[model samples]
Target: MRRAISVGRDQLMSVGVCFGKFTKSGKFKLHITALDYLAQYAKFKLWIKPNGEMQFLYGNHIAKAHVGRISEDVPEHQGIVIFSMADVPLGFGVTARSTVDIRKLQPTDIVVFHQADVGEYLREQDTLF
Candidate 1:
């Protein structure tokens, strides 16, 4: 229902779904394939290096140094699309830091994108399919 509103398309034909909640900004948030789908139109995007990919997949925070590129105009609270070096959206999250602040941080310092602790969510999706 929300995806139709966010992206403005509502021809969904799925029989069942396992969706998460929405960000305060009113963007519907989900993990996995939705990231790739949203990447098509979402303006705010950030990418991480290969080194950070493993930890990111395991649901770890992406550090400042690991981040490759992020939209400069994105503010601190807006939702951002987290992508890979290969340009694949990895997940979604509200930005905890602005672009300028992220630029001044040290390599190991945490930047943002608090990947949700969705271990059970992923496990549930696996079983549902």
Candidate 2:
């Protein structure tokens, strides 16, 4: 995928598999495949407990208590890829609080705000190409 993307970057311009697109403000809103790809390379990630995996797939935000591990130095409002403890890419979201700030948060406090998830494929199958 990397080779394909890099090779066609200049010539293709608007064709090929899209990972995601940069917003006007320069934030890269990740697509599911992009999230999965970045999960192995980027530090902005969260591995949730099993109990929360289903909820997250259903488009619910993650709570502090449900988080099993968080990558270091994640800032608040940063886009992050969500994963199950077994390392499956489930979705993506924005952090509600920084890694440091989470220390003072309650168990029920919102951690990651859901943006997209695998369940959306099932829920929106009719609209999906």
| Candidate number of the best lDDT | 2
On residues 1-129, what C-alpha lDDT tens digit does candidate 2 reach at each position?
A: 565666655675454555766889999765554665666776698999999999899889999999999999999999888889998888889999999999899999999999888887788666433
Relative to the true structure, candidate 2 reaches a TM of 0.75
Candidate 2, lDDT over the whole model: 0.84
After superposing candidate 1 on the true structure, give the runs of residues whose Cα lies further than 4 Å from its correct spot: 1-33, 116-129
Candidate 1: residue pairs that collide = none
Model 2: worst 10 consecutive residues (lDDT sum): 8-17
**Span of 10 residues, lowest total lDDT, candidate 1:** 8-17
Q: Tell me, by TM-score, which candidate is best.
A: 2
Residue 25 displacement in candidate 1 (angstroms)? 17
Q: Show the colliding residue pairs in model 2.
A: none
CA shift of 91, model 2, Å: 1.0
